[model samples]
Target: MGRAPCCDKANVKKGPWSPEEDSRLKDFIEKYGTGGNWIALPQKAGLKRCGKSCRLRWLNYLRPNIKHGDFSDDEDKIICSLFASIGSRWSIIAAQLPGRTDNDIKNYWNTKLKKKLMGMIPSTHRKPPPFPTIPLRTTPPPPSSSLSSLYNDCSPYYTSTNSLTGLESISAAPHNFLNTSTTTSLAINCSLLQTQDILLSPLQYYPVKDSLIMFGGDQASCSSSDGSCSQISYGKEIKQEDMGLHQSHMISNGFEENQRFMFDYGHNGSDHSLNTWSSTDLKPNGYLGNTALEYDLEEVKQLISSSSNGCNSFFFNDESKTQERALYY
Candidate 1:
């Protein structure tokens, strides 16, 4: 079987919607409300489009009282922070932003920010340097009875005395492994000593020489208090081939210091403008939401434009992915 069609797939209107349809959706929604469920909305609103289509139309276009125009500095900071902490949860990201949609935010990240990030990589095809293997204790000491051992059972170190150097022990009795490794379950009492087998997320530890990949976990990026990653900056002495990767690592540490900085630079104007808009109580949907819709309309427009132009998608598992990339921030 071929399968069902979306709105008959024949006369179904595609591309840009007419102003008349926009008016109908706007007027009907204004009067009767969207009732929260978009699928049944066309029937209730008496529109020619399907529910999903209606939802998209309203979310992407017709929704009014929108803040249109240029992306302010705060938007940039939020984009960086949100992307760093959350990879591609547009809805979750949109919630943090007052008047943006998931579709809109997704589009901006993919089209604009993605290009900005990739551009930071130099044109020279220099091979990135090999990542240094962190010198773990050459020999892992025997596990104490209190330690839950690794299945790998690879002992590269041996304890010399009853006293563990803390960094050389395998059975890290005093180590709080949870604070270190998300993958490994080695427990230790921090009061005794720090665990040697610290696990770093692919994002947390990108080698500065390689602009091709960023690696590390959320903790590796910054303090886990609010899921914000940090950013660090290296001087110009670093080679161009390594700047992107180097900046990526430094950014995680450095950016954390300037989390408030990005906001202060980018958002002060937006905050004032938003407060003015908020005074009107002009809802994006015009009726249904308590606050404005939790999505970025501008981001949605950009996404639609990019998709129409055959652009790649930039999604987040959460906000951390974007925040981890320093240049983008």
Candidate 2:
């Protein structure tokens, strides 16, 4: 069966309402409400207009207290906010603003408010994010060419969206980059940092002999005032001694047999929140003498298979970091 008629379109008049038609429709609705059925109202009121046309004219214009045009600032803000949240649900948006009609709002947004919103283009794409900003405290020598090449390549590692606690926090490099663990990995390369008393170091680290370098710990961290004190700051360089470990020290710590393997962080840098991590001494390879570190500067990338059922972390998210940042470069 075809759709039932709401009214006889053949019998209904269409086009702009004249004064006489408006008067009659207004009088009928005031004396007797729509009686719960718009489809039959026009015929009962003896108008040559469709029930929809009568309903629209009455509700959009003739109805008592119906507001037309001249949207205020508060109203515009409401429109923009709701548009962002719910997206173009005009009728719902209309309900939030007293006396505003959905049709009026829909038209105003399309015709005028949309243009005003476009002018705020610069307001949207905020500060560069997902990385910490570094302050220029002292100019250390440029990072070594190999370390520079690693950053340029972005790899030899897993990227956990985890905000880095330290280069020292890395558990260990996978046997290769293809490890199926969801754990995020970061690869660290050392250059050097010159010491300043006032500056709080973001991280001070030494390249591990054959393991992922750990940050925020004594084992992986370069100590201040020691001859091997160095740092690996974000996008910057600091020279650090390799664990201050002499062959005797490495042997004593039982580290010689497993020269390269997983790094176990005994810390999350929580203790260093005071930010006093800095070193005054600059030694090329710490007490290891002329022994060079076996290092790779490639960042390893891996796809995250699933998100966590993890608890709330103390680490900063991307948005908060952006807001708190003073400068990115």
Candidate 3:
């Protein structure tokens, strides 16, 4: 069955609000402050409008310090960045821009910002970019007696002294995945071979025993606080063929599907501009194909800038999954 309406439809004034109605809503809100219930606000304000309608009018139009008219370039960047990262969480996007409401941001995105971004890209190159190909270096496995021995030799960051059963065991205590204090030579060798060629999201950090454990995805990228030992961990089960497919799936399913707009800046020659920007501002030494080994505030600014230029892709689920293993650390 259909849910009942919040208010009576009959005898409620609709359409454009008159000056008198606007004045009453504004004055009532200014004096009484919505009385904490929008559904009961209309009658209290002596307006013939529906409570919902009155609320919309007051919030969108009559609210104090409400920003109207054109959106600034900075606001455009913030909206695009937040949208790319969080999808259509308009309220969260609105919070970043002062004097703007979720309704305003939504309307601007639908009518203006989306088109402005689309216009930045040439029409001929509108198709999705081919998935990035990362080449893995061939290195002889370290001379360890067995696979278990190798894992123990490489993973000095793990708090547990007992040998892990398998790759899945690493997942069981994902929190102790990287130790910042010590860098195992084997871990560096493994990291060098397993190239991180995609900038999927910002690098997130977790505090572990007076050290920081940096994580991005299943590929365990880490760096010490003192800027020593930038190493990433890869599961033994992950094959070269599987890495390509898995990274592609992570990009396609995790990000591309969430892109509300059809335009992709990565394909339309905008990557050069993005790369230039990141190189200059963020000082990211890695190539466009390689992900950043460390997180910086500047990288975030670059992400927002790239997003505004139409590179509408982002990383999610890093925080929740990290939190799940909080008990282990």
Candidate 4:
């Protein structure tokens, strides 16, 4: 069967939008709100256009209150928090940022921010996602041997464990780590040593390992200071790492067994809400580490109010404010 014609494509005015059409749509919405009935909107707005077209033009381009210009630092926080809360649902996030659109934001995220984040992650951690293709080879390698070798190539051999009861709480609900409020990008890689999984040394407070050595993305910029692990903020290296793992003996001697992988939190140096709740170190605000324990929406409202004035507003709650202050120094 042939495909049906589009509602707006038949005997309809199309192509470059005229100023009259723009004015009609704007004035109609201003006077009587976006009625959500696009099919009827063009007639009401007195424009020779389809409802879908009007909706797209207004939502993606001409919304009056839309914030246009480079995204601000605070907007970055909102993006991170949204990513942590809901992975890649850019449309939902755009709803929160008044004037933004899902398409524009999604493009910026994939191109610019994603590149910077991939830099902080290790090379080994990111495996090229599998692509689908039917093999035409007359005689394929034995399935078992091929599968075993692949495992040997990308086996996860290292796992980092943190003892804070709070991490235990956070990990308990693996879903909560991606809560609506925090912005954290998690990428981990484990390089194989002869012994298999390497137990991370608790001796170091924080550790950064390079993981992306195979495909030649970004390397070297993925180290961490053991000291800052105690804080919410994580750090990165100044330059990219050298990519020498491709043909090194590390892969030849069946010693591909000795190769290393990368892991990353993609955590920029933002002060996370305190998670520490121990009586001994608990601040007046009752936080555990950087996660907030008790706070109110009014405080959030207050911070949001302050942010409008082009100021650096702390987290909406008192405990968050304290951590933000400490982060300044």
Candidate 5:
């Protein structure tokens, strides 16, 4: 059965709130408060509006200390950093900035901030560059070579090379190479490789035992000491039918296991710069640690500054231009 509606649909006013309606809502809430139920507040306030509409109007427009002026440069940094880290969790992002609401940030992001960021880069760099393919083989690595050393020999750019070993194509570049855009590219590439028939060369292959040894044998499955258990296949091809099962396995185990199987890259530093950012952290999240965070801020500032000369500039260096741009917000 269909659920009952919250209020009478035909009797309620639905369009933009009139000035008289706003005054009544503001006065009622100021005097009697919400009575702890938004669904019932509108009727008590003597308004014909829906409770949801009244709630939105009261919170977004009539709330005290709500700032509707232009967003500052620091606000822009906070928004961009939070967006890069958490992607569109507007309420969480809004919490970081006082007097700014989630709806305002979301609208600014969609209509202005997104376009400003995209316009900073050339059209060519916006698209992912072609990646080189690795040949498939079953040969083992040299006894003296470590996983970290082997991955370091790979190239950053996706270009063909004569090296027979498949390690040359993998990226061992520093964390600075991973910006918001490159991280996005990596995410796309990783998703495509998992779904598609892309193959990796033998040099990129590592036995389950090797992964256990490299990652300090901390994984639950790696705790087994039997030689037979260590011989389990690590880099076998996954068919489309097995994707769901594979994902379930990943959920049970963790993404680290999937990373171990898919990318043979190694972490060398004590800080583990290659580790992805944690979304829960209050600070800026960067794929490449502190360096990436700094780069992200600089990039945002540069883009905003460069766009000052445009017809619809959000940023202004001149004091005179600031007042003009302020009117648009």
Candidate 6:
């Protein structure tokens, strides 16, 4: 059997409401309110209308502060954004738009707004960009003599995404890049975050000839105590006076004559812009950072010729699996 009607169809009026009917519904509601039950409101107001019909008339047209007509651009944006997030929940969308009825928004979305938005939509005619090009490997994968024998295992090196991509381009670098079987390179990069047992370590120190992939991220990039800094030139020949080194460390590096060793660096332990590798960032007392030991020119030649720990053939590591390891200071 079909369900019973809300109000007797024979007794109640249907179709468009007249001016008198709209006035009666509006006057009755404003003075007494809905009294919590819309189903009984029409009967109480002595109207030959369905309770649902009276309610719809009051909410959609007769209500105070009721808005009608074209929506504004800001309103269009709000509707679009809300619709994208929650979809066709007309009542919720209406709540955000002050004075707009849910039925009105529903009608607007269905008959006009939906079509307007569709008209504004961009066409999918243009093709997507092509994938990047990586060169094919000319040589086989690297050997098993990985970086543990080279740079001692360190934590992850934090660099920009582009730097990491550069390192991954070439997996196997030449072993002789280290200049030492025991890894005497200046730069070191490593990470312990991955689950894979295999790691990739690509290292190239100062005076490295191969020019393997370099990853650069300096924790000391902000070595200045103030608020500004500049990169010190790598491989730049600095005089002893300009170098920000401790007096003892310089003495250990070997001193030929007092004037020659300390002249390049400033005499007052000052890291002047002129004396600097052009670095203006100095501690209040004047120190950029502890520089690597500066070996005397004569002593370096003597060490190269010495049989023990001599500057001899270099080395490096290339493995099957690869991870990027780069150290920049």
| Cα RMSD, each candidate | 24.2, 25.0, 20.0, 22.5, 21.7, 29.4
Q: So what's the TM-score on candidate 2?
A: 0.37
1-329 per-residue lDDT for model 1 (tens digits)? 97575555554466677888889888887777777776667767767677778777776555643345555544543454345333454554454444455677778877555433222222349652233222322443344321112101211121112222323322211223212222221111111112212111122222222222222222221111111113222211223333333334333442222221111010112222221212133233212112211212223233334434542132221243344233222
Tell me the spans in candidate 2 whose CA falls farther than 4 Å from its real position: 120-329
Model 6: how far is 198 from its true place, Å?
Answer: 44
Q: Which ten residues in a row have the lowest lDDT in candidate 6?
A: 150-159
Error of 2 at 313 (Å): 32
TM-score-best of 3 and 5: 3
How many clashes does each candidate structure show, in the order listed? 62, 22, 1, 31, 0, 12
TM-score of 6: 0.36
TM-score of 3: 0.42
lDDT of 2: 0.38
**Candidate 5 clashing pairs, residues 3+ apart or interchain:** none
Candidate 2 lDDT at 320 equals: 29
Writing each residue's lDDT as its tens digit, candidate 6 over 1-329 gives 99898888899999999999989888888778878777788899989999888877876787765678887654554454334323454554555565666787778766555534332222346542232223222442233222121111110111112111213211223333322333222222111100011122222223232222232212112111111122211232333332334233334543213211221122222323233211233333222233312332222222223312321111111220011111111
Q: lDDT per residue, candidate 3, 43-119, as tens digits? A: 88888788778777766677655678887654664465445444455654554555576788888887655544332
Winning model by TM-score:
3
Clashes of 4: 31
Local accuracy of candidate 5 as per-residue lDDT tens digits, 99-192: 6667888888776665444332223555633434233223543433321222222222222222222122133222332222222111111211
Q: Write the per-residue lDDT of candidate 4 for residues 143-261, one digit (tens) a residue.
A: 22221122222222211132121122122223422331333322221111101211111111222333211110111111111111111222333222111222123223322221112
TM-score of each predicted structure versus truth? 0.37, 0.37, 0.42, 0.36, 0.41, 0.36
lDDT of 5: 0.41
Residue range with the least summed lDDT across 10 consecutive positions in model 3 = 184-193
